[model samples]
Target: MGAHQITIVDMDIVETSNLHRQALYTEDDALNMVPKVHAIKEHIARINHHVDVQTYYQEITSNNIEDILDEVKPDIVIDGMDHFKIRYLINEVCHKHQIPWVYGAAVGNKGTVYGIDFKGPCLKCLLKQMPSSGESCAINGVLPTIITQVASYEVAEVLRYLSGEGFSKKLITIDTWHIDFKAMNVDILKNHACEICANQHYSLLETKHQQHIESLCGRTYLFRYQSSIFEHAHHLPGEIVKSTSFAKLIKDDDYEITLFKDGRMNVYGIEDDEEAFKLYHSYLKALK
Candidate 1:
């Protein structure tokens, strides 16, 4: 609703490992940065002086979500995150409050961007299930050009919508490998049974799903242990592998731990959820 001031709520950070696909970052860019929100805010300020920006270096968990939304009170929200969990939360928040937000994703040479208006179908309408467990840019590999292209398209749509220009409620897909682009018009395919929008259910904002830390999409996770556990983490016997400056990947025989500064973990090569929990506890004990 406002002119140019937009608040960006992101919990991740700039990392050396992400430089390839993170076109906006350099090793020194995140040398001492603790959160992604801060890094992105600074980057935007440096490049686009016409935009008003604020950064929240905290996760959009159930507990602090309402408070952050209220604090930022953004006229428009943007999806700078790779994870879908928080996007779900944003959808619910925007729809309930009548705010609009944009969604974007890039992997390898491909990506997609879409805008969610308050009056139509939301993210849930595009898919029939939850995100499957798998690899990410950290697990797989992404090029800088693709990520930049995706974010550029996302911002383009944001600018258009914010400036009284409306975008198609359809899905926009692009494949940079072949330079192919297509916009699928689906404005009439909105679902009346969407659990988040149509149901008026704000379950994600209720505080139950919020974990101490969370792994976003892209085979990345954060291991946020209690402050008391910091010193103990040194006792663990293996090198903690990390993405440039974005995420830490710690692995051993039975498992791999992808941890972020936000205190979340993405456990891979393990089938059992209980085992994931056990691994989490094992790492927690070491950190303690």
Candidate 2:
């Protein structure tokens, strides 16, 4: 908690649905549609003005993750994402950079926390392959209590790693609804043949594995292309709903677009990939 500097990265804005589980955001934030990174920077300033806060209103993709980590040179990295694709990327990059990291996840009153010191087993070592899609908070619902508990556990591990106390080398599993908590040694899970950690092969870093377009929850789509929206600001065809230093929200009859300065666009109210790609290409034409 007393860390002198903190870096936060997120491309999403505050949504009314997030209020139940995410404590840092307020109803006003959702109403104003504040980017999560900006909201966090503001809140953290109120909590501790002495702490230097660096915010990046961008998503972590394979194309930019290594550069982001290289620029920050963080002593440790913490995982707060919902999907495993990004986690795998983080795991591989952090492993390559020799930075320790803590992996955490919470859904439906159950959560898991594990730490990797790079000297021992890593996430790939424990999870040999990408897991099958499972129930998410969007579908199954999560308790606010579980989010807080899991986050507390993650911060504690960060502190432990930063203080040179070392890791417990145990995977913590918690089910708060049943008041069950278990920690089992995970050092035995290390595989000598693991590609990322043991053999130093980072597959997730490859661009071919990274999709530029993705279907998000709630009929939303994200199109990630690295271009400066400011260069095409004059040609946007929608009413500017909201404009910020790092991104702009534009809305038309058919779609709502939040285009970042780095060209990551999130389109809301789209249900089909064909329509989504059509709209994306039309915008690209406009930009040209």
Candidate 3:
């Protein structure tokens, strides 16, 4: 298969914290303001320039979803997003479109990888019995080894499916801390009368989840908005404040926001690169 035929949809950025477990990143890689998808694409290109990679620097919310999936037209989608909202979005979009996708999650020293081929149970099918999302790395703090291990398994599954190696329709969980791995059959449960699966309902993807914000002393980068336009405002350089505790508001030539200790802030300046760049640095000072 040609490299250009595969496109990974990841909208996150490389953070200083992710270096501890992410194997393919360097200090300079994290320093660059590139989105995680682009960063991974660039890294892959170094190994094989023939691979066609793409990215969307915006969060997967109710808005801008069609544009993302439409632009990618990927043969299969991979899970690189941390946001549960986005994960569910991918699940529903894939199920609705009948485009199979893989599910994976890692945190601390454990993770899981599974595939959702058309004949197998989907993420929503599993969620009918389990919780909405698996344990997130943000809350548990992922180990570099754990992410690498889980990601490698995920990639292996991808290769298997694409190379006609054929993947098992089972859920695979790995616990690196204990060095345990297990896979169980789940194909039959897909049609076992589940709300999200049997009934073909996808409440998680259909709903809109809000993000919270917090203010810190000596800095300001929080903004409040009740408009849908603000959803796509990601490309415009702005912090999304989900909390209402921040009472103080500030603005400058091209940025406006408030800051809190919880590390949440908003930016509203000139909706362009120059202003976004300046505000990002200014916010970084507060982040420090």
Q: Rate the local accuracy (lDDT) of all candidates.
A: 0.68, 0.83, 0.60
lDDT of 1 by residue, 70-100 (tens): 8877767778766677678778788888888
Worst 10 residues of 2 by lDDT: 131-140
Each model's TM-score?
A: 0.79, 0.85, 0.68
Deviation of model 3 at 111, angstroms: 1.0
Please give the ranking of all candidate structures by TM-score, highest first, separated by commas: 2, 1, 3
Clashes of 2: 0
Can you tell me which runs of candidate 3 are displaced by over 4 Å? 129-139, 208-288
TM-score of 3: 0.68
Leading candidate by TM-score = 2
* Residues 41-118 of candidate 3: C-alpha lDDT, one tens digit per residue: 778889898776665544465555656777877777778755455677777778766777778887678888887775
10 residues in a row with least lDDT, candidate 1: 212-221
Q: List all candidate RMSDs to the true structure.
A: 4.2, 2.9, 9.7
Indicate which candidate wins on lDDT: 2
Per-candidate clashes come to 19, 0, 22
Q: Which stretches of candidate 1 lie over 4 Å from their true place?
A: 1-4, 30-34, 48-52, 135-140, 211-221, 235-275
Query: For model 2, how does the per-residue alpha-carbon lDDT over 44-158 read when each residue is reduced to its tens digit?
Result: 8898899899988777888889889889999999989877878888999999999999999888889999988789899998888875333364576778888888888888889
Error of 3 at 43 (Å): 2.1
